[model samples]
Target: MPYPLLHAKAALDELKLAARSAPGIMVGVTIATTALANVPGMGDAKANWNSLAKALEVEYPNLIGNAVFLSRAGWIADDREAFLNAASVFSGDLQKLSGLCYTMEGQVDQVRDAYALYWMEIGLLAATVLGYLLACQAMKLTPHLRAAGEILLARLTLLTNAMIAQKTKVLYGFLAVAGGTLATSSQSLGQLFNIQPTESAAINFERAVIPTDPPSVYLAPKRELPARPKQQQR
Candidate 1:
């Protein structure tokens, strides 16, 4: 029988759905960090935070002229990155992205009713952007580690999908391979327990053993502690 167009495409439908939903997991974090990026003289975290209370002061001005805007139009879109990008511009706090205190402020908010919230969003976004950039840079620069991460991620995806399908035999096979490889690597650092061409498990069972060695850190420090009496008077 010929496959229908929809049937051929259904395999990735769940993955696409999951990807769409996963973006929300980080949305709150982005929004929160963006708000914190906008406060002025924001260094010395303690001082910045103290001033932030005053900065956050949103008073009723009907149509105030000195207000700050964190999310645009009194609110932000659900897309965290876009919201953060806007907040950074609104506060003029890119330096905050470098872990430095932002000393700039914008007077674009006409309501004065939202300065506090705007200030907060800018601060939060600055921190988050810095963190994201650092993480992305590290991941990009480290290829071996990145490969290891990808392998682990692939295994997780496999496990999740397999578990849902109840194909436990495949899961068990994967576990066996993983466990055996790890066991082999751990048990044999040199030539002893490694599998050899003429070796049989029945004949090699006795050779599997770990060596005993004094850990380097446990060596005497060359300084002595005074001895305590074995028993104290009751």
Candidate 2:
């Protein structure tokens, strides 16, 4: 398998793992929100939980689906090195995205009571910390998703352009071969019948120039005709 494909597969695997683990993260978030609601004046934490849940349930999955589609589309990497480089970056971004769910779960698990007289203060502080972490992760997530998209687009463009160039070369090669065969056959038939073969601009253009070679080398040689006989007295 090509390196680009390998990296793409790794990225897709990470995305799948993240998607599979999201429901578990959601459960942890729900528990954390429940605990926070039991304390007085933790509305902000609950709001944050709602936002995070929406991301996990809706936005994250949508992004993953897009990534999967792009990755599959970009599987035929004409520029292997460039594609591999882009795929590696995307793979790293995907790993970070997948790790977010685990990180969030860990943070949620740490919402225990401090059991001090300032327990309310401690709970609020914990909520603040968790909220801050969640916010940071959210910020990072958006950019990583955007980067993944850009990388895929760039590689796809490269692949597309390369394919077009290759196909054009092949088409030109086929035309050159067909034109030569036709010209040779026509000349042979013209000779057998003792007739002059006609030439056309299109056939001349097809036979004379090869796009891949230097024009000077492929141009037909100019032949000097025998000196015309001096005009006889009429």
Candidate 3:
């Protein structure tokens, strides 16, 4: 068995829900953060909330790209060290990104109880995404949340979904831009792993020839009479 396949699979299974809900979660977090941005003491920290949200925007695609790389790496069944090391490093990167969210959430909470609660919900969303990466790295799923926590998470999820439903066009535009970013990231990751297109999928870069001829051709007329006259004189 590969080193992390089973673990990664399990974590992915768990994360699928989170991944599907990320946009809504981010929308909620954005609304909450914006609401609290003007609160006392949050002046310096306002940007952090937006930054965390922006970071999260790339996270889903990053995970998907990493999963593709991991799968390709597994199939190739070579360079385990490189793959595992990259996975380890990538997991740390995920954790660090999550830490930024966690910190911003904490700072928001410090300003007011309502803001704190709002951010705690955001933290839960962060945990759902980052927790899976951590689980993949440790090969152990995090413990389930208590009943109360589950209820709150569910409600927040519902609220975010409703908000998303009301703002489809905006989310669509955001996702379009995100899709472009994901393509770039995926391309870089493919290069890192030396991933190539399958035979059927390979591109033909050879230039095509366009057959054409000149519109007209010109030739000098022979001076037959002059030539005859010169021979007669000779």
Rank the candidate models, highest TM-score first. Answer: 3, 2, 1
* Poorly placed runs, candidate 1 (over 4 Å): 1-110, 147-234
The candidate 3 region of ten consecutive residues with least summed lDDT is: 3-12
Comparing 1 and 2 on lDDT, the stronger one = 2
Summing lDDT over every window of 10 consecutive residues in candidate 1, give the lowest-scoring window: 101-110
Evaluated with lDDT, which candidate comes out highest?
A: 3
- Tell me each candidate's TM-score: 0.17, 0.23, 0.24
Residue lDDT tens for model 2, 1-234: 544334333433432333242322232222222222232222334345446645655676567667655766544345555665765665555455444533433333222111111233323433443443344345446866656554543443344334334433544455466556546644643454464346642355455765555456554556898999999999
Q: lDDT of all predictions, in order shown?
A: 0.38, 0.42, 0.49
1-234, model 3: which lDDT tens digit per residue? Answer: 332233323433443445453334544444433333233445446566657645654775478567857677434244566776777677665555555555555544444344334434444544565554343333322345445444555565665445534343443455466556546644653454565677978766686465566548765555666544545555
How does candidate 3 score on lDDT? 0.49
Error of 2 at 8 (Å): 32
Ranking by lDDT, best first?
A: 3, 2, 1
Q: What CA RMSD would you report for each candidate?
A: 34.4, 32.4, 25.0
Compared with the true structure, what per-residue lDDT tens digits does model 1 show for residues 1-234?
222222222322333333242333233333222322232222234354334433433222211323324324644235555655555454443222212211111111211214343333333433443344445445546886776544544444443333323332433445466556545543443333353566353556577776667677765446788998799669
Indicate which candidate wins on TM-score: 3
